[model samples]
Target: MSGAHAPAVVFDAVTVRYADSPAPALRSASFVVEEGELAVVAGRTGAGKSTLLGAVNGTVPHFTGGHLSGRVTVAGLDTRTHRPRDLADVVGVVRQDPLAGFVTDTVEEELAYTLEQLAVAPTAMRRRVEEVLDVLGIADLRDAPLSDLSGGQQQRVAIGSVLTAGPRVLVLDEPTSALDPAGAEEVLATLSRLVHDLGLTVVVSEHRLERIVGLADHLLLVHDDGTVTDGEPAALLATAPLAPPVVHLGRWAGWDPLPLTVRAARREARDLRTALETSTPPPGPAVPAPPAAAPVLLEGLGISVRHGDVTAVDGIDLGLAGGEVVALMGRNGSGKSSLLWALHGTGPRSAGAVEVRAGDTTVDPSRESPAQRRRHVGLVPQSAGDLLYLATVDAECRQADHEARAPAGTARGHLDRLAPGIPGDRHPRDLSEGQRLALVVAVQLTAAPDVLLLDEPTRGLDYPAKEALTRLLRRLAEDGAAVLVATHDVEFAAGVADRAVVMAGGAVVADGRARDVLCDSPAFAPQVAKVLSPQRLLTVAEVRRAFAAPPSADGARDLGGAGGGAGGSAPYPVLGGRR
Candidate 1:
């Protein structure tokens, strides 16, 4: 209640240069976030967003060993003078990777760990932990082992742990990146409540702008050049290079005020809808049928993975054809990642037959050596760090090239192509979240395996990076490689995947063409399809393709139409098999 009108966070011409860096990561940046304000930071990957967030808690220069100039103050405490540990009571920083921040084994203990370290009174700590558990709606997970929790649950626990400390300023880095749509909505709604009811000054950074843009009271754009732009969300998004489909549709339709949410777009889309009523634009291409001679790259018969008494993956029969891209989608702990690992033969499988075919040879991946398995079916795990070991990016790529028996720079070449701006001398751990995933993916791709599996490939990627990844995967699929991507990004799935396989309770619930499956599913539909429902429009690109000059004097074009409901009255018939 005190200092309510004061700025909770202030960056006064802050400049940060990391060790051995060519230029400053963040240069001459200045911004102020008032108390109780929900500010969202948006930028491309490796664009100094993390540096800005770290500055608030004094982690950038002090903990990260970066050269800092100028001043950053959180809750009137100068970050330069106060170490992160000292400022922990006022500023709670939750990292992009929840596992990195988790220190305790159980959810309850994790939540209480921060308060315990601060030496808060026993009774106060207990009350705070219980309040956080209920606030995050994770009461059921209080006694659950943190390791056993799914990615989304772990993320919620991480946030709850920080919340238990009762920091005035909450700083989160990509808090909902791993969450499903419903989980993301829940987390954002919780943040909104905190800002409104508790008046917490929440500063969050997210690459998925569509989900957070509308929730933000203020917007800060971190450009790659280390400059910053601060303004209202609608004003910043009007000219932002990377934005959601709804914003794109609003821009294309020339709405007076650009809409950041689907509800806003629906309200402003009446005129556009009327214009498209007369035009019956042809639907986009259907999912291509598998070739007649299509070799089954990877096939699983009666696949099941069990952990203790729980069956993570249960009796799932699936096949991935050459030259096909399939998306594995579901909520947290739905066995999508479990099945990916089991199919790649890395995880423990109680009962399964995983046979991968290359040319005239078909071998069970479960029995093959690591090297042979990499050559046959390469898998990039959800934690990409699992595949990286070398100190530097250059060293890792060289090791990958050597392991694949390729030229010295072959893997490095692949990495450069996948992520162009990544510094070769930088450590893999030093790279951005998106950059690290890209490096691991490119390293695996150097083997040129027949089958490629990626787990949550678009976690921290910006729209442009996601677009690049989409093109890369499509090209790989066209080159006769079988690509299986297990992801929470429904929009990315809608873009790159030909076939979609939805998992629930360790079994395949729905498997069909991307359009047919996503259009009908409420939880999986993209923003564009959600706004322009009943029209089968899935992407902004699809809407652009269907654009035609309206039969009017103003010379405007009919961009798209609206859908009836969440499931959408869109008559896209289901395809393929379902459980």
Candidate 2:
């Protein structure tokens, strides 16, 4: 068992670069994971986070065709002479792209394939699969067709398959990238369980820090130039200025030794409240909560789509107005995406009302042309870089601006805001996922559309990236943009959206304030909601407002962002609820 503080893995002067490549993905990288500890690895996509993890299981050069040097010892064995299979006794891995490891069509079959390779007895294999599936709460999916499963569900199957092998060290690469809010919650819960119950050495490479921040015993930050900073999660986060907004906000808000959990945030708020008591009372009455915005008004809608003879989203009524962000929730195969497409006129929706009132004109989506609709609506697809085939990031934005009729330089402002150091000559798609998302958004913002739709925008982002995205989207809404995000990230939705709507079987199930909707529905509540308020503020500042030190003499805000980790709070209890 990789017990607390018991070293289980080590790396010495590790360096990797593909054959003939100009620069190495990892340069002299070194780290260690104690037995029974949860280690988190973060960097922008393409920051060599994946390459680093692959090195541990001997996949760096073995599977990726990269040049490798230096020693990579896992569980007391050097990996230089060991193939991935040779390290089978020491490590089990889950990648950001679970499909990378999948070859079977059924969950059980996939698991069995791995077990059989290890020569585990048939009886033990079944028992092991059952226990792991139960741990992941995917027993019901054991016989389900792999192709029929959503990305999140598929990842669970992938993870279950690996866990069945009973490797001492588990390394997951962006393991939660594909999960929806509920599915993400399930996955994080399981990782925590693996660390605490099974006492396995767990190493996870991810972008989103909020999910595992509280559970992490160790944290590593990977810079694009192949530089890394390693330390305790809280210590590293508080000092990493370019880190996620939540961490920044936590440090500034003076969260008393700071906290990584909701309960800790709550306690900090209580402390702030005590400080507030020392201040003089205000002359005027307290301010009310923000006002509710008007509902979107949609006229006739006609949509054409077929999922096995059934329309995903039929002719429906929908519209988006100012000051609102809506979460279009639904199971995979539902028409939520189709409805969004129909609204944007990106796809044909046969026969019905589709009108959007902006300022003077009533834009009828059904009657509009493709180019016309694009000018009024912005969209960030699942694969955001899909439309980017350009030679440079600046070129992508410049073209989009030209198409949108905005000033050619309008894109540069947005681009600079999102990525301060990115040059115009850099290829957009070649950047990391977070960078790609930011670049795409910058390009889209040049159009300044009234309605913006994003599909799974947080798919490959780290905690910092995800939080920045939430803040960015919220700012867009505040600037009078109606943003509709199709996401599985309930926490992101809770943090950024003013409104929430869940779609099921091709229709809207419910719609209301984000807090009311998310808190009331577990399926859509963020993983953090298990321990925090349903209004899980997306930023550390917002979290501080709810849980940090009190307002000043005049009720002024404290903006430094300091301290984290519960020096107090009995224990950050695990929560259980179904969405």
Candidate 3:
């Protein structure tokens, strides 16, 4: 497509198939990204999105041992002839997991590692490293340990590390999945500035489409059949089933062009707001369990976690009841994961009483063995792959069956229920980010513990997969399992959580109903909530119901059922003790 200057990246009839795979990951994929353009690739989990991004930087066939055909070019360099290392000067690759890309301990060292490998001169390397550190706004973290930085900070460093190499084209896969709203904004802003000022050609694949939809110049949609539809974001989003809440609102309100950002939605919200004036919404679903003297699934009293001089989690008390779904929300390094690990009894716990109560049997996680603790409480780490070890999916399932004392094919059955299309014989590591998480979750569910804990579970899932997970969690809660999820996905929280807990600086700041806390909080509110502010609405479903209800003389609506507003104190609902 480039008449004079060559395109930044090109995929010419490229198809990639993994070893022993039934179908190709990507088939007949062809596209050209012009110089200084920003392209976003989107798709469902296991739908060949990552495979396509890998092709651009030459990591598909070379690093991943896949059968490759056709051709891929980056900055006029053919990827087929150049391995990822060979094309380091032309293309930069940052993975979904930022921790995996770190090779040095400190932020400054990590930025310089690439330049050192390329054997840049000392003076030039120093200048480049400083430039990138400032460019990504990580100069403050130059001497900080990579482990000490928060998830968002670490991600910025990862980007800066690759940036020091001065690659013309940058490819990132789900760069903002683990970040909080503010952190995600920072990353996206940096990318936008790079594209405009530095003239960097960027291709990023992200599941959280709302963050990037407004900034993208081109949209590449990869489908389950391994075909891609490239077009403008607005046109594609008009008909896309996996669109964000703002887009859905636009379709419902009949706006000429869908609003990709909250500001645009707000500007168009006046007419819809007037239509909803006299509408009264129906009642919300009743919480399944009534106040009863049920056994507590999990409890923590004065629990604390510390590393060196830093107290990650302070003295805190928390509990989870059977049939309760609670969302732990906070900014990065806010001790959500720390509290979860302490409750599961897998990580360090300096001081606290962590207990799991099931059918009159009380087990202290600190005193129980690994198997014993797992039987009562199951935890899926942020790195889901860490929990999977067997060679084949079938073998892993079989081993889980044996370990959990589950019936024959029980683990496999659960795996099928959670993620249906995964092959039993495929290796766990080879699966996509979403599929791998599904496998780990299914494995943990096989134990059928009274309490389930998940950390950032929706990192790489598409909208469809996220909806499935939401349904699955609801079902688990109905089955009397206490589900605690530590996530930054506000939309997922609104859909799944009945109660919301906000943590900050290792302390609980707010605990209330999902609607109130989510609607009231500024940073954690969903897009729809911001668009329809002052109404305390948390989801598009609410808006639909509000509009569908009968109109009254006053034109008022009340969508209430669960606990009241988010600003009350109810003694924090103790668990495992009394009803």
Lowest summed lDDT across 10 adjacent residues in model 1 is found at 570-579
Please, what is the whole-model Cα lDDT of each candidate in the order they appear?
0.82, 0.69, 0.81
Candidate no. 2 TM-score: 0.77
Candidate 1: where are CA atoms >4 Å away? 1-5, 139-144, 147-150, 274-288, 548-579
In candidate 1, which residue pairs clash? 533-563
lDDT of 3: 0.81
Top model by TM-score, which number? 3
Give the alpha carbon lDDT tens digit for every residue of 1-579 in model 1: 233445799999999998778889898999999999999998888889988999999988887897999998887788778899888888888887788778889998999898888999999998999888888789998899998877678877888888888889999999898888888887788889889988899999998888989888999999878999999988877777767768877877778788889899988877766655544354544554677987888999999999899898999999999888899999898998889889988888899799999668799877888888889999887778777888998988888888888888888777777777677788888787778877888788888899999989787888777877777888898899999999989888877887889999999999877877899899999887788777666776666545643434444344342211112112111110000
Deviation from native of the Cα of residue 438 in model 3, angstroms: 2.1
Report per-prediction Cα RMSD to one decimal. Answer: 6.1, 7.1, 5.9
Candidate 3 per-residue lDDT, tens place, 1-579, comes to 332367898888888998877789888988888888889999877788888998888888898888989988887788777788888987888887788779889999999999999999999999999899878888888999998887778888888988999999999999999898888888899999899999999999998887888899988999877888888888998886667777877887778777888899999998776666556453333334435965578889998999789887999899898887899999998999999999988779989898899567778876877767777889988889888888999999998888888898988888788777677788888787777887888888888888999999888888767777777788898888999999999888887888888899988888777777888899989887898776667667677667656556666665544321111111111000000
TM-score-superior candidate, 1 or 3: 3
Q: Write the per-residue lDDT of candidate 2 for residues 480-510, one digit (tens) a residue.
A: 7788898876656666676677777777777
Pull out the clashing pairs in model 3. Answer: 277-555, 278-555
Worst 10 residues of 3 by lDDT: 570-579
Tell me each candidate's TM-score.
0.90, 0.77, 0.91
